[model samples]
Target: MELNDKIEKALHAEQKDHEISAGWRLILASALGIGFGSVGFATYAIGAFIDPLGKEFGWSRAEVQGAIAFGVGLGGFAAPIIGMLIDRYGGRSIAIYGLLGVTVGYLMASTAGGNLCYFYLAYAAVAVLGAGSGPVSWTRAVAARFDRRRGLALALTLSGTGMAAIVVPPYAVLLVENFGWRVGYVGLACLPLFALPFVLLFFFPAKSGPAAAAAAPVSTDAASAPPTGLTLKQATSSYRFWLLLFSILAMYLGITGIVPNLIPALTDKGFTPSAAAAVQSVYGFSLIVARLGIGWLLDRFWGPAVAALVLTSPVMACLILIGEPNYATAIIASALIGAAAGAELDLLAFFTARYFGIRNYGRIYGFLYTGVAFGAGLGPVAFAYLSDLTGSYNASFQGALVLFALGGTSILFLGRYPNLSAETRPANH
Candidate 1:
């Protein structure tokens, strides 16, 4: 009887550890939700609209890109609040409602005529409504379900952005080319609806309740027990949190700046819109590869070291883009930039889990993501403004080079991940 009990206990433990096998449905749903979510869809699709909106409204590139900066940066301010909500209420209702709001926001954008305020307002609506649909909610859900495979799971989930990158650029370009740009916005708006059924079906296991059970459903033990880790106050006091925050901010500034402008820059250099979008597609492919590859590397290696190596690729990409490069050169530069962009989000999520644990993961990650949103929001406008002032993108690319170097180097000082099992004790530097 004792031997039989031991065998039963061992079997239960083995079943509980089956991360991917037990939770593949949830993972698939997360990837789909994130791919169509605000971060993936809005980020990739906005670039296609920049030139079209500018031409239609007689606006400058900076003026056109300003809407994104305004909406995303301001919307990002709500992340900590949204994070708190996810912590209390769960991500399912938040993500679903957020996606619906985004659809309405995009419809508002499609109705824009010559009023820049209306355009900005439309985007602001998207950002505000869509905040819950971003990584903070989605990653929190995925983190609760995996431990040994956490890095890979996050990589898979974040690959949605990569998938968005692949699909959105060419698709948006096609819509603008055939249909009017107004119609283009409508087409983009419809994408979030497609993910709704998936989210409803697979986002959480049926047995999970709100809060703790909803956030964590890997097993009965995990579902019933409260999560362990530092609170928001505890996490913010650490230099590591601040370091990760600013490092991500700097990286996004350079990356986000380049991506929106890439289409215009290529077209300026004599590539057709179709050709420019193809290069962007290459960048998207690199994103998928990097997300998976970097996630794998983070699992096996020190994350900061992996981050340093990945982030520095943009410097070389910047150097290439500063000059008049050929088709092949443009592809190479795009791929390098894509690699860094791909790695950054998952790295942020992975670091948050490893350093802080999952107890207050939503709020901590949300606050940190605010910096990312600002950098992303600001990068495009800054790049466009620099181009308008200097008559070239060279100045902007040069500035990105500096920011990338600074961002990559800052994380090297983050040292090592603390053992969060001991997080109840004071955090030592």
Candidate 2:
């Protein structure tokens, strides 16, 4: 047998006894879906009560929005550290603990009586929990488990965010309208607590099958690196790390920050609140459609081919917005934007694995998540501030269009790099 053939056999032997078991994938997906769905309810649903909270508490808009910033800021601090922990320990323990934090935060929030500190505490607590339960935990786990279908698994795991976006808003609206904000908060608080019991029951490493099983040490030769992970310091030192960082910043900057702000921007363009909301729903629904569609494509196409297709979506959305058409135009834009948002999360995870080895994935992914936090945290507030300055949504929307196009252009370069799985480095040497 040729030397390369021997290398292939050794790697194949690593997979002889274990593989990512289907049952485990289902459990992880369910845990992610529920945990993410609950957090989604807690985060996005708060908008429904913004007016009511302000009216009752007499707080200014800045003060109210400040609570959101506090939460995001706290997340920025917790996520990277948690990632390091996940790299050192494992994902299951952190996920369970994080869910418990969210439950406690929301429970405290349910009893809050107009005290700003109380609201801040609740939001901050949830932020800490977010580090453990969000994409950083589950997506990394899925990526580590599946190689050929890694992209699809990531898409499935992250589809949780879309699921939350789809279900939470309306549920929150109904809760606030019928039962009152206090009752709504209590219900939301209970969701994380409820999720905790199930995660403890089914989310286990043994369930992940072979991928989670301990492997022998990697050899020094070209053929040796195992599919699992590395220490945090070793991960950061690689050239692949920088590539992943730039890729994330290029793609994530506009998408995470701009899409949420689209809700208010559409309303500003003469659409009624209900019509604007419907448009938002269209965008959220697109995520569900796009993720499934992209997952299918990832299994068959090269990563960049699928990536380019996904990147085009935001450009289409921006074009629709610039056209300044009627409600139908707005809805179309929303759908495209939704698709782009849906695909980015999975693609980012794919990019990380495609560019970097899966060993040390948690820390590397956590660092990447920090960039996501920066984009998500700053995007809406920056857009809102720009709207105030420009006195129009069109100008702000146009700015987003430029950024979206730039992100699309970046994906074209991805095809030029050597496949990380092959153990060859990019020519940037």
Candidate 3:
């Protein structure tokens, strides 16, 4: 009845929640990881097939590329709405259903009737699944299950994307070369089916210990001090929110936005496709290295410190890119940029939870993911446009260098507020 009693009850609920099994957490995290990884493949794979697809369908380059952009925009449009729903309903339910949608979308895309409109339809459906089933959903799921090792947990979950980058592109290239792009897409459809059994039926149990007990109703004013959750309005008003937004924008704009174009950019600069693909492989390799390294740093240091370290990759990459367009330099630059991107994405989700409590994590993470979408989605088109205007890939890349630098500088400004309040901080043995 009293406020103190309510605080005690809330604490009790948290303690009970921690009783969840580690095995359960790992299974859910891995399943969500694979699902999110597939999203990366879906978004970037089209670029590799652009000329081929256009040739087969008799569509112009801009028209086919426009369809890819449309899918990205549609995904961004759907993110906030999906976030709101996840905040209202649990992420498990949404993730399970969205994976099914992804399967259907991929199957349709793989078998698209040589028409530009068919590609648009398949991609639009893929966009819907992406908003509901990607990092935002996975991060929310991790947030619900763990409180003490939250950073490590989040980093592990997001490492899926980096892994996908390392693994998927080469496999896609092989599939497209040997069989055709269509078969490569069919392979993607199988990813969601694999994820579904683990997440829907195996890993995601209905309720953890405390969530079940806390189901009883209590008077709102008496049960919580300010209340148990954050709303979108309250989140947008916070300073950290905007800082995170710009940080993600800069990372995406300078790094991931350019990643899918790395091979083509090298080819334009006089390297053969084989040479360019080799350079791209270095980029993919660094993503895995960065994820493992940053995951360790995130668990041991302040969020900003880890972020600053990760941000260095883009700045370094830009310097190399601007100095020379040769194969060696491009390889180094591409790897650096790729590593930074892989690490930054994981850090963004980890920091979002560290800085903001996980009470309304889905909604907050959704908004942040939107900022990421804007940067990554528009990045390639913008780079190409700038190249068209300047008549050089160097000029466009130089612009990206500036953006990466600006983003790196901003991370140094994250003030040293402790990650958790004394009451929320972990208890010593």
Candidate 4:
């Protein structure tokens, strides 16, 4: 009987290992979905489109950039509602519909015939309809799947944006150059369609099998069950929530504002357009490195400290660009900015899980993501407006310096992570 028990235990352990290995499919699917989703393709590709659309429509830089601000800002209002749906219904179906909506949105955008209002309306449709394909759903799925390596897993998932950053700039430039901006929009629309199949196949949670058993949290106790943290109201009421919101707003206002403008800024400094795009590719590579590196650091070190260090690197980037930088210097600055941009989403996802817990993750992350969307939308417009006003990007870079400092400092006060599991909660009244 003892020998039989040992053999059974050995087989069970082997089976558990196999089950854990299967979870990588979930990670890969989530990464692909995120890379091609609205946050990935739409946000990163906007920079390449900015000059073409502006020249074509005879619009100013600010006017050209405002489309994203108008779209993502207004669309962000839908995040909490989407979050509620995800928490109740799960992410897979929502992601499928959202990707399809993005495809249609891109087609609509492609049909714009130089009417500025029409362009804005098309982007607005993309934001409103495609909100489900954003980080809110993808991060929720990833956060639910991994606990021990949650930070790194979230990093890898969000690295899809990094991949988009690398591919979209050059690709967008190529399309706009070869086929015109209209065709460029048509090509961009195909990305989410590519991601849809992956999400359908792997984003779903396993049920009634060894895979399900492996996917389950290692701890099977009541404390380790799903929905293990503060409610949305409770999270909102906490001081940390407000602080995090402010940090996100400031960091994105600086980072996202600068990214879409980097190519233009480089071109202004005497680099050719293709050379500028190459620098953007370098920035994208930095994004991938930052996501993986900062993610690993978050798991081993205090998260806020890691965030503070990474977020502040962009201050140096701003300083570098404030002067007339050499091509190599410009590349370094772009890389620094990309590192901060890469770290921002990873920190937001990891912090949401660590500080707020996963009980209300969908809703909580959705509310926080509203800040991300708004900041992203507004940043480019703000940067362009500043450039338009001053006739130089230096003033905008100076403002970013301040924003990055303030944003980095705020997170340091997040203090330690709280234990908000159901078992740890105190009964009220």
Candidate 5:
């Protein structure tokens, strides 16, 4: 406790001396840690495994993608439990467990022997802890610490995934090219280990900051402040919650369903595999800009409006998909897709905190992210399944247009956001 005070005091002194707040640095560290692990291992790297897994097992695309659906969907269902754990406990233990679990999953995947079930179980180990070390766990600590700039803080945290997308996919491709898919999985397994120390030391701060705890008020101020939003239960009961949930679900389904197939899709369009990876790298750049830009917008304007506007990128990408895209069209289309994909969680987390307030944040956000997970699981399979059935990606891309529009349009109905009071929210929290 005394050590925490000293660190906390020094952090204050640093901020007082006109350096960046230690909280902001911690938020950046959290983003980097999550980007290094979750983004590298789960999101971007998985695409590289699709061909190798299929070639080894003689499985269909949908069959291979089943791992993404089952693992990510199951992880979403597990989120409420993880969120409760976050509320009761700080995110430190959950983050640790998540890293360990993902590592184990990747290790087990590295040992796959052409068995579909083996791959499923391994990826399940990784996704089951989705919320633990992900935005769900990391954002709470950030949210607790920042109010005024919370939108940007959450954006920065989620940008770690963007950074991961930028580097991990191409790097995974390099590993696969040089060593093989098994070795690539093993390499990914080791990524979280490198980030673990940063997470423990900086990402997860003391549960309640010394400054916040000191100024926290008792029950007498409850009526005066009047809580801004609902608990998890109330959130679930409202149309507002359902609107947000389904919107996220629809958007993410369109995203994850197609993302793992990006290289293949591009390669089919006449780009070489290396060129495909470069295109994806460009996508990553666009995703990073969109995430940070959306973050900046949320702090200033209505988030749903920003979401609705950005969500159109996917719609435009889908229209481009209807055509036989050339080099320029493919890259432009990809950048739009990346923009839509990147803005998702930033909007979800930001909207959750804004609409619901901080009281039941962990649990409410957890429930909402289940939509994200469920959509993630549903997407790739649906995409692959549609491709297999239709014998072309044109149908799948056309279908994505509907999903994107639906999600973007749905957010318009969340009603007005209520403002919370500082009395209920302690500063330096």
Candidate 6:
């Protein structure tokens, strides 16, 4: 038999034993690592700090939100570089050590005295440290394995992020309430430490032979041999890429801006601090559900259609929050926001594969993710500035409603994916 055929036969025989593949373990580890990285450390931690920071430093809401805007936004611009490194060197060292860098940065934040610059500088370092530790590394590893259930695998991996969201916010609140934000920083550092052991899984390759060649399902016309998809240049020039890109940006502006400010916004509306934190936990619960649910749906349904539905969800959330919300309305809105935010990164990863193909998956997704990150930065600041100007967050929610509608509408134009291969087909044509 041929060498390729021989490898395939061995893989088939190994499968007959009905054992789970090495890939699934990597998926588990990926979830843990990605969960606590930027998702928990930065995204969830910042919300808890806003009130404390405002009281301690007397910083305006705009100034506080600007910290996240600059940190996560600039770090997002580094995604393509991080993605390139992962493609070349693999993700294990970067995943573990990158988080170690984040730990150090978080430690640095606890040291800031009177100077606001120190706080901003510390967050900038955390953002840079956090770049590799996010979905670019974890999701890429999961995407490389499990073509049959790729959606489910990706969802499970990203769900670690949701798990962190569910746990981190309230924990941060408790720590801040008792020990202050400095001890809260220590608490945030501990989250990534929980995932440190899982870093070893990224050290091993998921699959090792001919059957492992394609990272995902091969497109029909390109299925005979190994399939490499469109180059970065071709992908950037396509309508599908732009459509998906702007859609993610808008959806995140609604999610990222609103999520971190949820507690403050709710408390302003007459809810107590503890009650708002409880409501925020509802958002976390919804995120866990959406991450898994959206992943399953992506595996079975049309990508753009799912994107439209999820993107529109935040509009409903914003409307509910703006329109004389009750206890139940608060719960429902928080859940919608969670579902929207949780689905954004996973959908970006899946859509990158489905529309652009998987050859330059990391690079294309990185560029797109930059937009998501930038929007995350924009969302908080936008909400804060509007709140500062109008004396309430109601204006911010109305703005989010408009942006969400535009974003949801754009994806409908993506039409069909060509699944173009980079090596065989001429991208210029």
Candidate number with greatest TM-score: 1
Ranking of candidates on TM-score, top first: 1, 4, 6, 5, 3, 2
TM-score of each: 0.92, 0.80, 0.82, 0.91, 0.88, 0.89
Best by lDDT: 1
lDDT of 3 at 43: 45
Worst 10 residues of 5 by lDDT: 219-228
Per-residue lDDT of 1-429 in model 5, one digit per residue for the tens? 999999988865554333225466777767866676443337567777777777877988888788888788778877878877776667788887787777888888899897889888887888775447766787777766666567777788888887877888898899998899999989888888877887767765545333434445554433223233456786788787888888999998888766777777776667777788777777778888998899888878988788888886788888987788887887898889889877898888888878777667788998888898888888888888887888777888888899999988888778778765555553333
Residues 1-429, model 2: lDDT tens digits: 699999988876564223335545544554354335323444455555555577889864345555656776678667778767766577788787777777777777778897989888887887876558766677666766566555566676677767666765566557866888788777777666656666777665322212433343344432223454444576677765655566556555566445555545665677754555566667668887898788768767776767767776677677777666588888788778778877777777777766655665666777877766666665555555666677655665666777667665566566543444533321111
Q: How many residue pairs clash in each candidate?
A: 0, 7, 0, 0, 4, 3
Q: What's the C-alpha lDDT at position 341 in model 3?
A: 72
| Candidate structures ordered by lDDT, highest first | 1, 4, 6, 5, 3, 2
* Cα misplacement distance, residue 232 of candidate 4 (Å): 0.7
> Per-residue lDDT tens digits of candidate 1, residues 43-137?
67777888888787899999988988998887789888888888776788888888887888899999999999999999898889887788887
lDDT by residue (tens digit), candidate 4, 211-329: 33344464453323444667789899999999999999999999889888888888888888788888988888999999999988987899999999999899999999999998899
lDDT of 2 at 241: 63
Question: What's the lDDT for residue 191 in model 5?
Answer: 81
- List per-candidate RMSD values in Å: 4.2, 5.8, 6.7, 4.7, 6.3, 5.2
Return the lDDT, model 6, position 336. Answer: 89
